[model samples]
Target: MPLEQIRPSHIHQYQNFLEKRELSSTTVRIYLTLIKVICLCINNSSYNLYFSMYSYKR
Candidate 1:
């Protein structure tokens, strides 16, 4: 699924799926944290790229 299409509901559903699979709580939390970090990195990169382009146009 596209990152832009992902929502809080999707994350919650993922957590529920993980729990249903019997994954340990620690493992589920780690997975969620990694997802959040990856999203943050991608968002920051996009912001930086946009800023660079805007600055170049100035």
Candidate 2:
């Protein structure tokens, strides 16, 4: 998927992916943080707060 289609919750799923791959929590947080910043940049809006993967899994 395009990076633009990615949202904050996608970052969480990515964290879960990292976990399943035995990545560290700190690493997960770092990746999520970067993804969050990128998503904000792409959206060109800072109104987004962190979102849970469950919220958008539908």
Backbone clash tally (model 1): 0
Query: What are the Cα lDDT values of the candidates?
Result: 0.90, 0.71
Residue 29 in model 2: lDDT: 83
Would you estimate the TM-scores of all the predictions?
Answer: 0.74, 0.56
lDDT tens digits, residue span 1-58, model 1 = 8999999999999999999999999999999998997788688988667666778552
lDDT of 2: 0.71
| Predicted structure 2, TM vs. truth | 0.56
Candidate 2, 29: how far from true, in Å?
Answer: 0.2
Candidate with the greatest lDDT versus the true structure: 1
lDDT of 2 by residue, 19-57 (tens): 999888898788878776766666763434334322476
